[model samples]
Target: MSKVYILMGVSGVGKTTLGMMLAEELSVPFYDADNFHSASNKEKMQNGIPLTDLDREGWLGKMSSLIPEWQSSNGGVLACSALKEKYRNQLAGGIDKDLEWIFLFEDFSIIADRISKRKLHFFNPDLLKSQYDTLEPPDYGIHIKVENSPEESLKEILQKLNMPEFGIIGLGVMGKSLALNMAGKNFLVSVYNRREGELEENIAQNFVDKYSDKYQLQGFDDLKNFVFSLKSPKKILLMIKAGDPIDEIIEELIPFLKTGDLILDGGNSHFKDTERRLEKLSELGIHFLGVGISGGEDGALNGPSIMPGGSKEGYNRVKDLLGSIAAKDRLERPCCNYIGPGSSGHYVKMVHNGIEYGEMQLIAEFYYFMRYFQDRSPEAISKVFTEWNLKQISFLLEITADILLKKENNQYLLDKVLDIAGQKGTGGWTTVAALEVGVSLDTITASVFARNISAFKKHKNQVRELYKLKNKADLEITDDELFKSYRSASVINHSIGFELLRIASVEYGWNLNFSEIARIWTNGCIIRSSFMEKLSGIYDSTKSSHLLLYPDIAEKLNEDQEIFTRIIPAILSQGCPMQVCSSALNYFLSFTRENTPANLIQAQRDYFGAHTYERIDKPRGEYFHSNWKPE
Candidate 1:
């Protein structure tokens, strides 16, 4: 974005000379406030008389009014001796937000020596001391020492004027934490949050107030000031809520921005919406990136898995700073990467959440089996999960173990919590995307349904009173057996999610790198686990669209398949709903089977609606319709 730059200093500080040079280099118009001075004021300075603030009021007002007019027509450079605080404020009053000031100064002797050589100027050399006494140097604007070469001084001015390298809009938990993360990496950061909500009265100002002394961070409440604070081709990350709010913010922010500025949507936005926004912004010469951020608040503060997708050049511009703030893999590579073109970053993140839903549901089922069917206490279940975590380390399992151990008033906190689970729509998005891509995501889909079923609390209570449910205390399954079942379900869950990505990658021309996605997930995501670390290596070595088709993974599945065969029926016999596990087993069985009852369904379709079925005895592409009754 463009801005009006003001060059301010004492008379002999070379403001006019440097301002002219900078205007030429920037290809903008230049103005000298000295030429706008009143004839009476100049005459007093010429006769060694100092002008009072009263004498300068009209002069400052006229110069201030010219700022907005100059800024409206491509930005302009103005040289002025705005020696007093009030005078500087007056000059900024016309266009308060988009003005950047550069202050040039030097030793008194050097300035005096330079002033002595001037002959044609109207101002008398005797008045130079009065100008110095009237000066009130600002602490905020870019300050450059003019004792250096003019070229060096100009270079310093330009460098210092590019105040902030990164800008973050919204200062919510995730946004606030992420801004700190970027600032921790030594990147100059500009943070903005609208002062509308009750809690947002001074959010950005408060953030800068708390941390500015420790880091190079500036905060702004005004959108225009925030937008203008960033350097050219601004890189901004929007960490606000997704949906219409994001679009509204973009609309409000666009007027202050210019072409080539990049905006990244870092919320859990629907990929279709991301695709639409990307196309719209591209037409306006503004680059839009759909970035998927995971690992929650703590991860955002420390290091999270960052998935960014958009224009290649746009990614390149912010990749370094993002990489510096992202979590590192075992080999010390950042978890952040350019995911793919279009909305693939959000797409991958949606699938990631789908797999998370499945894994969480399966873990919850494990807890239910132990607490209800096996009559184990919450403390005992915590121990079971802790032991299981040692065997198959995962973020979900680790947290589950921790959650079960939490107590309030000497009672297990898990007992007091409601059973109904909440979803944030990404899992549903994954299910919908799976259907659109023709991928059977039964494991993840079952998880989404399980949450929906939990939400029908009233109906469930009515059914509970109507029918007596069986308690399977007599049914004993060893921890080893339960872990095996859980692991088996999780494997299928991940496989289905990856298969969706594989198909969608082809459908959308994303050409996604499965290994890189897995690699990034190894450390900083909710699903991070030793299994993902292994899967990363598996994808690096094997070339397969389906994770189950990899020889190593298939061998592991073969070893684990026997436990599912026994446990699935046993668990279902107790009236326990093992949706994720049973769905996974059914999916596995169908995928492995050479033939299925789908042929009968196809025949039924053909008999009823003329949706023809292929003939097994004929070539693969040959199809035939059937007439059931007439034939």
Candidate 2:
């Protein structure tokens, strides 16, 4: 295990600085556990007051359990003021740190002087006396004599720890580059590979191969042998292809994995696969994560959108190691925040793809109209789509416009594309789930249908050949009528899709925050738009079971019936299924009716429950038994 160190002292005691330097001296990472403090603790600290022991207990517990896995592999130093026996006890139970503490202590006057000189930050200088007052000198091991210079104290502590460093798995382009990046961050890395060639490459890539001494490149020939090359708990980030290759490697490595061993699936794996892996590995007591590594290869080596989903316990283990390497959110919080259960991360990714499908379809439809029906050239269509990105649509759609503008293979490739789209399992899963939960996935289903129809070269051919009949209505349509009708129809269809999403979210117990989901998509996944933000907040102001009734959203759809009206006629003319969208629109419209299919069904329900039916124009509110009995 890596050297487990905690920079213990008050706010102004220079914990962050000493911890960074000490970890650097030991050639390991540093986790500022204080950064992991919850909102309330942070607020308490910001208020220039010391947190009561009761207030700090759970927070300390959380931070303490976090450092073990980092230490379990190549240990790193973490900064937390383990000022009390209880606080240290809580951390001791949770983190399983083997009673190792290089307590960084300083005089109250010195700490106050150090704090007053620093620029404004979260911690308060006014609380300096309170921290010293609350401090409990640890029943400790090696103590850094911080009575001297910071560097001297750090050097004394490192000498005691006798820190030994190692490299990382893989030494090819990605592995080699990652090694360099870590080393650039001043971390000594041990690069490993299945072949000797990879190690050679890593050595060369290291500028002048300066890290030849720290670089411990070894062949992954034997499981135990490879395991020995790394430190405790063996933090192996499997950066291989997602699916079977990962599965096969895990099977080979399972036997050698220790109880607290950690395996991070930092690949483009589906969430379900992550879920499956978590479940399987948990039985072996091996911790695993389906970490969604966004930013592609470059992002992976530098920084990426890392959506890690697994046990909170496992996350605690490696929390110290991740540090600033993780992506930050809008709150300046680590993007490495735990998603949900085993596959919750991948599940989010799936929904990401599903929404992506809907967004792309919407853009595609817009592109199609501009190119053919509107009689615009590819360049003109691209320009219009690009212009539309200026609106509040999410990053998903904005990036889509970028993708549209880029020339592919010397073609306005979008124009050359067939009317059909391709899909993986996500879009289908969304629709299937909608059906299972009795939710109408109008847009998503329609996208799938469109993709299916794209494979209709023969059907298209036959339809063209059999086009003896002419659509007299389409031929006679005016511009006003066309836009008005089509726009309204599109609205109806879109409403139906959203309604399904709402219903499914409710039924499945996702506590689905349409607003939050929309906010995230504003920069991620697909269908990220300002419209979605408006849509997300729609449910916030009202508890309407039906989204079609949302006044603001409804206005957008209904205000211009001219455009959507075309969708209905076109769908009807083309024999496409409009059940998801149209059925929803019709459901809303018919809500005003006193006698509905649902009411009739309710009558049928009473006919079975009590064999009773209600009268249409009854003066009294009473149920009546069916007079017509079975013969």
Candidate 3:
């Protein structure tokens, strides 16, 4: 243990006890900041007086000076009331990232109760209010709730400190890559891939043979050995398939895992399935985390946005490890956070995939206009995408450019590839969830429908032969107009997805931080872009769940609507489907308008079936029935 550990919190939050326990576990020296307090300061605190900042300056400086000495000597743990940001900075001596700050937070009444129970402590229990008032919790650092036992807290701290002590149950693309990533970060990584047959090559062992020389990696074919190899409070990440496979693996591992062991499902499991597994594991005293990892195989190897929900205690234990392997946002913060509890991670990931589908379809519509309607060659279309990528800056846009550029045998490979698109159910799940929650996801639903229609290639070919549909000639638009239209549609696409997230957050009591979600999606994920970066700021500044209602956003939409409205119909005139674009335009039109034809629909319903309709002349929520045949 060569690192310095600072347990920072208000008084009577078990900092000293945890610090001493951690120090003993690591065989290091433990220093209590109270031991260095001046006699007068202690006397004032004993008389129920709170010490001012000026009074604690010297004590903090003394503790700061001892940091280098302790670091030089093996290591050390210090329990200090580093409540304020300035106090922690002073103690860190500008080396903030080097020292691990474990913030022990609990309810105010709990701290007050513990302080009242103190027999001979110099600090006054009455000064607890002043202490809490002075406290400014840092956003950084490892946060550990003080509700758990000291032993449990110590276990979390030690597990976080011990790098590379992680196990991966599956050595598939993501599993192997992530294992290497963790090992590359100096984690002791244990990997196991189940061998289905006696003659089957050991995937885990093969992985070790290839990369173990460069990294601290071990492979196990035996399930029990892999589970036993990890340190206590075993942190195992399962990168297997979602649904039944996840449940099967859990049941197999249940016998080997202990009471406090942690399991992280790093797959796109359904939120409901994750919730059920969480409840089941809680009954067995096993912690389960639904971890949504995005950015494909490459992102998994390098970095990706990680969303983990369920068992906050389990999350805290592995936060350091995940943060080490996750991508960085513009400010260089790790793109990983505990996204509330009970399967919210999977829910967010599902919406992210839905957004991805919409974005991909929008980009495809742009390509279709350029290639088919404008009759541009692949090289020319690739150039167009290159320019668009400069302005739009998204993973899908960048990859679309690459796909257009790829050629084999003097022909574009994209042209030879099948027109049908395949989906893995996440996008459909998102649409179904929106329907269940009464949220409109028109653009995402259209994207999913676009894919579904693409799958009917044979039927479409027959229909094309019967109708002889031809793309209209001489249909052209300026690049600037096209870009504006695409940008408008993209904005609407995200608006619908986030609106669903907002409604679902309320329905499920997730209390999601929209800004944090945007921040994390700004990098690594499939939808990463400068646009997402702008969105993160918008979410923070507006502090509103409905993104379309943000003043600046609404103003921009108002400006862009003219072109967006004209271009979709123009593309449709040229025989391009542009379903997502059309859906986006309709969604925006329906949402922004003050009145709609739905009033007539309500009248028709009331006339036919005596169903109720709200009166426009009366207050809202007042219902009236009409009968057309009663005359």
Candidate 4:
């Protein structure tokens, strides 16, 4: 998706100067319309003659012919004094390429002064009035005031197009927040939602009313008007539900879209579905982007970690816009980039959710250990979590502490919430993908299973009454020891998640950058923490297969492994199910061990099914069949 920009206005309005500056800034070529004029036309203009439409037909045709060549390459900026409506229509109307008309507006007095100072120019200052008289102000182009310096004008032009830059569908919480975020950055944003009922219309109107004064925001109830309001290379972002609703919207929007326009899905869509959509849309010459947006509602309002993947050219078209709205890390780098081709962004986000499930479950286990084994109240447990957070534990731990501290009518609010945690299926997607890729993601898998187990409240109650079990153990560990064990468990959980990403990257050809992933997650995300910053630094310097294999991480895990060993027995005896933490500990042990008992399992397979096994005496890939089954 290359784009052509035509800078248009009456003569002496500084279109050529500004067009040259814009071309230089965008790294594209610039062409002055004067260069394409016939020598006879130049001579006539030099003699203060106003050229009629007949005299301009050849010049306009030449500009129109060059459109395809520029679009096939990196695109070009052309400075032309296309004062008549018919002239602009001849130049840009019905073109297959994306052509934007940028009209540089200037006051008559300013134009007169600029022209009076101009030396060696063909157009006379006396002819300026005639030029203005012939000018038919464009109803479709971007009008930029030429009062500011060229650099400032170009800066404004790049960020704020004449028409709305984004047309956002589905005005839910995330959609509204993102619209407001883009508006706050001085972008013209058009927002829409399906007109389901009076309630839906009111919701959309309320959002527009709230921010219309502060930013250039518009709300449209009619879909056709909304689509018409957007500029070319249209970027329509869908923040609707993941499955059939998205398909429904696309089907409705296809009639309003043109070739090379982009449709970005910012929901937690299934990766396979995204891949299918990408292929389907590409057949029509439309680009479909699978964008992974994290950070929840608050993050959407402020900044969020954005992962966009689909067509590379489509990403290039919106790169600057995404960078402008994305959250910045401590180093002030935008936490957004082109993840890869196809559905890689959604895949990465799925794994992120899987890791989040593991992390939250581990925190729950820690809370249970404190509440049951140590007999600690909510406030006391919150205090411990707060202390660990100050030591750079994790954002999840920090938020958990705050959640525990929240109270209503002097009673803790968390205690009143339901025990059953709801999932939107991203965690399940990650677990399934791990199975497909032949990777071990046991800690995350256990976390997903834990959520299922929590749903069986009736079964648990019946089993508890039938057994009448009374196994209880007291934990006498110091707070420091508990904190170390928690930190070690957190590292192991993240390690498994990153290893899953590594395996999937190879299996799917995503070429995922582990360091960038850590960097982007350091802020504006649910799992953000100072630990991610450290992980980024470690990953940047080393190419370790597993995070635990990193020397610094290995040392920390080894130092805290003792604490985990001493505390697990006490915590488990009190009937606290440490699913995620216990699984992480086991995975850590298995990963570090050089040998396991899998040889016996292989022997049993060969004995029963005549399957082959590799012998120690033979080189790798050489198989031997066992005769232990009396075959």
Candidate 5:
């Protein structure tokens, strides 16, 4: 965190005075241009003549090249009359690449008089006119124009120019909205996006038109141009599409961007895609961020969930800015976190959607049961669903319940709805990643597969050629019993669903913090709820373990296990898919109670071609790999 105040102005302006004061306050090295000047320039200046642009070119180059070491190691202020834009531009190149420039301005007459009062110096009072003539005020830097007091200008620059921890890159819908949210709090914001259209769009949308020049939108034709648009010590984000375009964008930008520059893929990317890209990019010393953004178009245009990962160094560049922009969850924590290195952010999002699949299925199952088994009016079913949602449930579930209950144009929309549901690519992605990561996604995958099965209109038609599938018309259940069964089954589904996510975290190096993940889900993410808030709190004391081991949740399952058992048969009778849910909960309860799982036994057989078992007296002792058991 080296602060080097590079003072630029005509020779008579208060740059030297400010540089001296700034150095003393900061307690660091300070260099004056007068000391560094060549004898030729000094002789010319002493003879009441100003130095030309060409005369000062070498000096400017030297200063520009020197400051990088100072910026890297020990930094103070450099007092130089960076008279022209070209000279200042030279200072912006090479190792001085990330240099920040400051310009001190005073009226020509005001400065000439000041120079006249000065003691013996090479710069004569007569040369002030030519210095003013040479000066074309710098546009892309700090301009202090109050009085000629160096300390006053230094104070103002320190107050204003020292921006917040990080900045935003792109200024599209998501990026601009994020920037606006940050800049509203006076955070340092640097935005880059496509050059052709939407410059006005970003300005109008971000409300940055008020302070138009401050919140600059550096228009770029391509990714390389975009990278150049960012401030040095860059942290650029990719708020563009995923797939080939993301690669194209990063490939072009990588050469220009430094090792620490971040490229956030805030798209609905496949987790495996994230993993592969991050690995490739890391070799180039470039950081790749696969961030998962949920909450739809409005969410993109407003606040959204932000899951970031890949290159901890890159995230360290911009976490605070990202946090400020993300929507807050139940714990009042932002819906933003370092999801893990590489594709872990998108991986988490994939699992997030996987759980979403399960959650949606549960809702759909409840709807189907209400319609088919209970034979209740849509209104009656909606009432039941809404009432159930009044307890500590997710916003996704609660909203679904609300939507189910709502009368659309004075009619129950649920009654007129088609049975089929549409799914995007996330279902397939969740399954694919689970397979690769060795996570058991029975609940989430079953939910996704159920939707896939639903899409089989042709196959369903072909079912007429085979044995006719019998409808569950003979099944009967009481409302009290049915409601209890549905509720218990839903919990079982959720328990199993979270287990899949837990397994994914363990298998991959993605360190999914349950409390933080739950907090992020509260608002912008899909599985947001009071349940998550409570879940977040529970993980505080028991974070090392999985979500299934949360004491409160485990206790809830124990309390309701009896109810779940009684309701299981009724759920099956009602034609609901309670099988997977049942298996999940059973496995969880038994697995938590002991370590000798049947699946583990099967896994051992698969691995080593041997059957092994634990003795009753010695639970964790050597496995019994001996002869057959006596009947």
Candidate 6:
């Protein structure tokens, strides 16, 4: 059904002017009820005779008929002197449509002065008193004083119609920061979190108390009331845990949501789960958007890279708001966009975490090399890391330097922390995806395995005591050479990651933009770096299948390959584990090689299991079985 916006008031109150302006602004047809008045009624009003209720009957009937006609198309805006309750009832009661009444009210003296200045209008200035006496102000419709400009009035109308632009359905750290971020952008945000006890209640209350004075924020503990607080075509974002918890919350929210509402899941959810939810919610005319929000607590509070995917219509509705709250690049473009259909956003975020794992492992290996091989103390290592950061700027490197500099009770804090690292499945997901796509993500896979090995505390200790294993400390390398080797390995690790993304984009049909991904990761993400900006430039200039194959990157690798070659074996000889660095070197070498020994393995398979093998002299895909054992 179409909508009807009726600008109603006493004559000379600027109804026609405001209605025309509103119609143009809203892109709707404008209609003036006076144009539909009968000749006799116009004559009476022209001769200073007040229009009786009977005189308006024909005009009102014509308006009633014209309303539905305009509504049948794209809706309309009408300047109607619906000064009486009965007239408004007749205009609204005769149509099955959305009717929004806007009363432009002003003091009688102000309107009378404007009426006195009218030159060609039919209605006389003396009739203003009769119109006011007959007026019955509407209690339900929006009322705006005639004291504001047209633009201000239009803004107020849109705001009243779309208040509480976003409804956040969780109050955890991510949710709270997102709510405050929206509020900071001048968006009215309604926040809700399930309160099982006093702790959750206190958290909600504290957030409200802290930011309510500075922003337009409201906190709700009741789910039904929270849903009620939002405007029509509601946008509700859930920042709770993934999986079953998301399902439970959706089930609870479904009762309160109407058709055309949108529910966005902002957790690190599995893509398959997002696909299922999108399918299920769409049946009820509700849209589901799977959003991937990166950057930890600080990024949440400031600005984070937002990846939103799912329904295109849903994205259109929320794009401006998302952009308003997202981090901006050096050129100030928002780091948010509609990624693709279904769970593509989450898939990108998963790969992002996998690359994060590889980068973190590479830094750890460098730290270990400096500490054991070069016999550097924590402070010494921190100074070197800080110096390296000036030339190679990255979020991980900056934080690593900070961690190395931290001290507690006269001891290095990082040295006292446990060696075992905990993971939350994204790295493993990346590995699984690599296997599925037939791509090699060796560096990241090694990083995941290294974390697993670190968990074998008791077994490792027993083996160490049995063998009297010790790390050699005599090996040394200049800081410049070590930095070059680390940089080379980091490039190779990223090369494998981008390759996985390239293959997955083809397999998933997402048409993922590698340059856009790099641009977004330049800031407000865990893997943010000056290197990402350079990577974006590389992808923009050349569409290479692999980063290592790109001309600029390949040239850099050629210059640094010798340093990587020298460091890998030297670190191994010192008994210091360098799984990620070693894997990166091996991957680079294997990728660049023109030939490999896998041909012998193919022949072995053919001989032992009768598996087929292709001959070097024959065309591809024509297979033959070897009979070496029989011979």
Best TM-score among the predictions, by candidate number: 4
Assess each prediction's global lDDT (C-alpha) against the native. Answer: 0.88, 0.59, 0.87, 0.86, 0.67, 0.85
- Model 1: lDDT to the true structure: 0.88
Better of 2 and 4 by TM-score: 4
User: Stretches of candidate 6 above 4 Å error?
Assistant: 1-162, 541-544
Candidate 5 worst ten-residue window by lDDT: 216-225
The sequence of per-residue lDDT tens digits that candidate 4 reaches over residues 551-622 is: 999888888888876676566666768898788778877888999888999899998998889988889999
TM-scores across all candidates? 0.77, 0.58, 0.78, 0.79, 0.65, 0.77
Candidate 6 has an lDDT of 0.85
What TM-score number comes out for model 4? 0.79
lDDT of 3 by residue, 1-631 (tens): 2688899999999988998998998898999999999999999999998888899899999988989888877778899989998999888886533477788899999999999999978888999998888999875456788888999988877765554368998878888888877888888898988788865468888889999569888788998988767766678999998889999999999998877789999999999999999999999989999999998889898998999999998897789889999999978999999998899999999999999999999999888888888888878888877898898788888888899989899888887999999899999999999999999999999999999989887787689778966675466698888888999999999999889988998899988888899999998899999889888888863256688988878888888888889988988876778999999999988998899999899889988788899986999999998665655
After superposing all C-alphas onto the true structure, candidate 4 shows an RMSD in angstroms of 9.5
- Model 2: per-residue Cα lDDT over 506-528, one tens digit each: 65444444444434433232343
Q: In candidate 3, where is summed lDDT lowest over 10 consecutive residues?
A: 156-165
Question: How many clashing pairs does model 6 include?
Answer: 0
Model 3 spans with C-alpha error above 4 angstroms: 4-164, 198-200
Candidate 5's residue-wise lDDT over 1-631, tens digit each? 4656788888767777778887887788889977877889889889877677787777777776777778788777888887877877776553332356778887877887888899977778887777777778754456678483556677887764654333344555666666656666555655555445664444432444555666543333354544444444556666666688777766666678665456678777887778888898788777778888877655654568888878887776567667767887645777888877767788778777877777777667666766765567766776776666666566665677667676778897766776576777887788777677565666677777787777777676567777444344355555555555555555555555556566777787566776677677777776766666776676663345655666776677677667666666556654555534554455455656755466566556645765666666776766766544355
- Model 2 residue 58 lDDT? 76
Cα deviation at 318, candidate 2, in Å, is 5.2
State, as a TM-score between 0 and 1, how close model 2 is to the true structure: 0.58
Candidate 5 has a TM-score of: 0.65
Which pairs of residues collide in candidate 5? 310-342
Better of 3 and 6 by lDDT: 3
Deviation (Å) of 441 in candidate 2: 1.6
Residues 546-573 of candidate 6: C-alpha lDDT, one tens digit per residue: 7887899999999998888987878787
Per residue, candidate 1 scores C-alpha lDDT tens digits across 1-631 of 3578889988888988899999998999999999999999999888888888888899989988878778778889999989988899877873445577788888777898899999889878787888888888875557788988888899888776758978999998999999999889877899999878786787898999999778889899999999878876688999999999899999998887767789999999999999999999999888889999999998998999999988776887688788989999999999989999999999999999999999999999889988889888887998999999898899998999899889899998888989899888998989999989899999999999999989998897689889998987557788888988888888989999999988998899998998989999998889999999888888852355688888988888899889877897799888988999999999999999999999889988988899998988899998887787764
